[model samples]
Target chain A: MAISGGAKGILIFAALALLALALAGFITGAIGAAFVDKFSGDENVVHGWTGDVLPLDQPAVHLAPQYVFGDHAGDSLDYDNKEAKKYDDSSKIFNDNSFVITNTILSSLVTSGVLIFLFVLGTARMSVVPGRLQGLLESLVEGLLGFIESVMGAGKGRGVFPLIATIFLFVAFNAWLALIPIYQSFGVIEDGHLKATFLRPAGTDLNMPLALALISFFFVEILGIRAHGIGYFGEFFRFGNLLRGRILTGLIDVFVGLLEGISHLVRVVSFTFRLFGNMTAGEILLLVSSFLVAFLFSVPFYGLELLVGLIQAVIFAGLTVVFAAIAVAPHEAEEH
Target chain B: MADLGFHWPSLLVFLVNFGILLAVLYYFGYKRILAMLDQRSASIRDSLSEADRVRQESTQAREELEAQLGEARRAGQQVLEEARQAAERYREEEQARARAEAEDFLRRARTQIEQERNQAIEQVREHFADLAITAAERVIDRSLDRDAHRDLIERALSESAEAQRN
Candidate 1:
């Protein structure tokens, strides 16, 4: 019963959170656009040092040379302005700072890769008398598996654990990645002081979650087909029952199928936006809160940001599981 | 609005990142951890079954030993009782034989005494007879008279001859 309740709560909370996050993403994007426009003129001004150009017609430039590189001529020479040009061009393509090799990307890749590796290794060695690492991984997976099985009714949950676990790891790593001071130093020189800038969180970047969501959508349909065969395809058209006596039920089934398809499409959008909004909002909130009190008074909000990061990660993964479960469930089997 | 350009390298990097993550998880986390867990569970089960087998064998051996001991004790008691009975029977038979032998010796001694007594009586009788004969002969010689003395001698000589022949 606890398992069922937890599954239900996770599903419901994840769905609601995803919707809220989508709305928030839209709002933040709009607000951020406005904020950027409002503050565009207040860009920090720095002493730009120019040196010899490479064959690619790129000039070596350095910003706040004392902070990034010590006051050494060799350090200034080492700065590759071509890398900056590449970043500048990529940033233009995304219409945001997403394509740049920002701190968020590095942290996300490192943290997620490390965590997934450890978890998989631990699970591979799973035992009743497991070693410390294996035991921890087993317990975590078992808890999730038990919860999913209880809700989806045993045997029904196993097919989706891999997807769910992947989503969990990805979102968790990305969420935590956003918390680091990745964007705290990103800036463009306009006036005199160093003003901070931000790049989109890894999961918030649409491409990541969209790719995941599309994969989930494809598999869900595939599983339904495999489970029910051509009859599953009949869900979309479903005219045979109409030729028989059950016209109303057939129509209802068709309508429901259409609605389900629409929801599947919306899930991709929602899943992407949800992760994006949560991470972005947390990042923005931390930035703004810290700005309000300089730095000292914003310490407590960092704790809040950490909590939010964890919750958002859990919410994203939980929703992915729920969707995957619904997609693969033998709901059509009941009709038969 | 400034047009943003596409960079292929960043996209490639992203793909690479995803690939690496998937590979690492597949190799390190999934394979190794699951194998370890299976190994641990198997070992635990093996230990438990081994212990159970040993326990059963020990119990069986103890029961067999107890049964053998009980049989040995019963056999020992039987042997002890048999020896005691045999000793008692032998003692009784020897005692009965000794009592019979003692009775036979007493009867023989009685018979011998009777024979001796009879022999002595016979001897005594013979001597008396002889003495009487001698006395009569002496009287007749001394007094020698005629016809009356001759008759007394004849009678005494006949009596003495008869006693000597007996």
Candidate 2:
């Protein structure tokens, strides 16, 4: 709590410097310049160069990741220009093209590499008495396994842990990595504005979340079928009572079964959009904050995005565990 | 859906990427670490049980050693007590034998002294009678019958012996 005179002076000086930088960033940024042009009555002074220099172009939100390399990188540039034109006129139709190496794909590869490298380093010289990195890795694994076991029960939990933990870590790391300043800084620049970056968060891409959703969907259905045999489908198609001459109750059961079947399929769409929407919204929020104030303002949003990433990851993995548990449980045990 | 970037190829790629990651992480990270943990715990349990066994064995051995030492000490005391009693009995028997021999020698010495004193008294009586007869004869200047003197001395000695006997 106590600071020396010299240290106190240095601290005060640092705070003042940061305040000055934030104020300067605001004045030259998009909102502050619009006010300056309006009040100072000088259109030529600040507005001319600031518009060209500050990347003041509205953020282009394409649901797909732009290609940064490979054969489709040239087509990706054309597609970027088309997307940019749509923001100005609102009548242009967007062209969709499949590319070999998109920025999001690159980001996912980087995330995977980092995870593997960390694991290799932690487990290279493992012993009963662990060093710091080994200890950290061990505790992370144990904590994740403990949480999962608490949800799914101990014996069944370990059976599904690898898949659950991988999904959680991958999604969480992808979001966190995008929060780094360099991810948005350098990119393929066209027409004095940014087009595509070398990296983007994998979660932002529609395909990434779609892939995860499909994986989760299949895993859940397969587990159910394996657990209950053909009877798992009986939960969705209940015509058995109608065959036995209970007309009223059979109709109700049949209708409820129909609803259940639709809802089970709807899970895929819900899972996909939930992650993609959150990730895309976060990315856009960061872009808009920087466009509005340019500096010191997006820092808080970065913290918000960090919490969002963790929550989304936990939700994704936790839901999967719950679904798996439901799948494996005896559905008709209570009826008996 | 196309506007949302739903390409089949890209989704397939993502699936493959995830599959590879899962395989590597499961094999390299989770399996080995769990195995090592189980091994460490098992070894620790074995060591603890081994230590308990050694402590019990040492305690039992110490008790046995103490019991043996007590038994030896009691045996030694019993031998020493018997030796002491035997020595006391030998000393009493030797004392009794030495006292009986000394009493027997004292009785034999008393009988020999009585016989020597009686003999000396008889010799002294014979010499005294001879001297008296010689002196009477010298005064009378006549020869006295030797046989008569002798007879007279013998008769007097016989009567003295009879009186001493009575």
Candidate 3:
């Protein structure tokens, strides 16, 4: 059945949300288990390992450092610290060090590297009569640029088009990476239990999302300042009445500035969380659905996951563009 | 278990992850993609403008060619008309010359005929006068009386005069 654009958008959003939740759950579970283990007398509480590693006979309990990775043989790769002690668990891999580098970070790095390489190679070989790869890349870039130009106005849109397009690709690729079987496997257990492994959503990971938000935030302010100079800061301090009769208005301006400042702070948190929550939730949903019904039932959900990844990426990029446009644009002179 | 509360480590992990993601994307993905897009768009604009210029030039050339063709056609027509007029003038002049020559020939023939007629009349008169004198001399040689000769002479004179008058 042909899906409408809105339906497709919703489906994608839902998938991303599910993924975000799943990742968040895994992280929270690990962290919560670690903290609880610190207080509780349970021996497993300190190691913080959960999921399939916990025997079915024993109810899983929260522990300190809820996940562990590497083995005593020192053969395993430890993300947090290469020097961390290793122990031989069922799969010769012990401890969950997935959160140390953060699965989201690793995935983003991989996705970005691949995408940039493709983009550069494609561009280098572009021709009027394009080869297959060149043609595909050109069309994709052109189409995206056209869309941005339409929304942002031709003159300004061209400036931010690349930034927005890149964000879309990065987020989309990372989301797809999360759906891969290897990432979902976490660890293989000899006893027939699967340990939940990586818990990073490239966008949903608070560090990545917050940092992106902050960059956008900083640039927005900077652009505003550049455009308006001293006047841009005046929106915050509002000390225009130091000389004379405008004291009352200055005080009011200060209040307005304060409010604006608060909103800017909120922007950082909100932008970060919005992406993080959506992506984490989507991951969780997909995981639960698959766990309940196995691989066959999860097939349709994978399509949903693909759509969700795309939408989340678009939404993130779109928001960035909007914020950038607003920040850079000179504030209208206050209409008295 | 105590009611679940806010987890600081999770928050820290989230912050750390967000930081790395932003760094990677900003450097590798965003910057590069943006550069590529800008280059692509500029090229497209250049192509469109070039097309517009070529179209304008072609139109101008077509118009110029049409103008030249029109001028050539007008010149040819003018030349053809001048030639026709010259031919007509030449024909009229030839016809006039022929008519004048015919008139001159007719006038000369008429003058020649008049002169020839006058000469023939003079010759005939001389011959008649000579024949009359010979006849008178023969009559005188036959002899007769003075009064009879005088009467005969008067009758001859009167008859000669009458013959001359007829």
Candidate 4:
């Protein structure tokens, strides 16, 4: 709380130096270079000022994760160059040789590994009176279970908790992990540029979200069917009124059922795109901000991305819970 | 769809990855944590009920002890009251017996004194008669009839005794 004059002066000097570095970063960035070029009519202001340093290149975004390591990694495949007869039409992108591990897949494995390691370490020695790690894990698990139970009611929530909680933890951890500085900087560098980063957020890859979406879809539908028996399909097919000699109302019910069916299927797309879009946008925002102004400017956006990660995780898991709750709830069979 | 990066292998890998994670986590984490939580809550409930039972038992025991003490105190007081009454009765009986004995002794002593006084009075009357005869004979100094003197003295004494009695 108390500082001598010299320490205070040093603190002030450090603060000023940090500000000066931030200003220098802004001045050397693309916008500053453009401003200089516009004002002084210098065609290559960036080249003149930074001398050998190239301006930040546009961020390369791949919808499919690049195969950085395992099985045919860095192997350029030319269909025409392959044995003309052996390369069959059925085997387009994937053959025996094409089952390579992508960067996103590797990242997913890492994320899963981290989760496993944490769980193993936390549960190695468990007691009613928990130590720090166990206490933390217990509280986190309890909170997640409580949230699920709040939506699904107490006894039934435990059934779907593992899947829901996993989805949330996977998505959130992937986003947050990718935000680490090393994820951007430490990678296989090729020709003085990054060829592929070893770690990328799995949510940015379409397959990851698609996989999770499909899982959630199956989970909800299966639970619904299990709870209501074969009668669950009756929700999508309304022939009760048709049998009762009410053609007009029956047709309306049919149309509504059709809409309901379509909406249910559409949840998969919505789930996939929502996570993919936000994650991609956050990654781009971070990339662009750091490119535009190197250091201090992107800090706030990083904080925002943290919030975004948590929100997306919650939305994904929370929606699954709500959908599951609705699925198992009793249908209005008495409307007839 | 291809341009948007729909790859089958990646999807399969992700699904498999998630499945394994779920299995491992269920075994190692959620199941144990939930069980521990339930156990803790159960133990707490049991302890609370146990404490309540103990308190009730202690209160009951205290009440019983107090009741026993009161009964003992009451019994002691009753015994003391009975003893005091018995002692009072015994003292009165002793006083009554002593007073009766003393009165009986006084009556017997009064009868004996009355008998002794009668005897002494008889002896004194005998002595006085003898002395009167001696004095009469000395004054006369003349010989008289023994049987007639004896009869006269007896008659005189008898007449005097009768007069005294009247």
- Those runs of model 2 whose alpha carbons end farther than 4 Å from true positions after fitting are A38-55, A70-99, A332-336, B51-166
By the lDDT metric, which is better: model 3 or model 4? 4
Off by over 4 Å in 4: A1-14, A35-48, A51-55, A70-98, A333-336, B87-166
* lDDT tens digits, residue span A56-95, model 4: 4445666556667544342222222333543332224354
Ranking of models by TM-score: 4, 2, 3, 1
lDDT comparing candidate 3 with the true structure: 0.60
Worst 10 residues of 1 chain A by lDDT: A49-58
- The DockQ figures for the candidates are 0.09, 0.27, 0.06, 0.33
User: Which candidate leads in lDDT?
Assistant: 4
Instruction: Please provide, for model 3 over A72-96, each residue's C-alpha lDDT reduced to its tens digit, 9 standing for 90 to 100.
Output: 2112222123334333231222224
What is the iRMSD in Å for candidate 4?
3.4
The residue ranges of model 1 lying beyond 4 angstroms of the native Cα positions read A1-104, A116-160, A180-200, A245-247, A294-300, A326-328, A332-336, B1-16, B88-166
Q: Which of the two, 3 or 4, has more DockQ? A: 4
Off by over 4 Å in 3: A1-99, A143-153, A158-162, A180-183, A186-191, A198-200, A239-253, A295-300, A333-336, B1-93, B123-166
Evaluated at residue B6, the lDDT of candidate 2 is 69
Superposing all C-alpha atoms, what RMSD in Å does each candidate have to the true structure?
Answer: 15.4, 8.7, 11.8, 8.0
Rank list by lDDT:
4, 2, 3, 1
Looking at model 1, residue B47 earns an lDDT score of 92
In model 4 chain A, the worst 10-residue window by lDDT is A74-83
Error of 4 at B138 (Å): 28
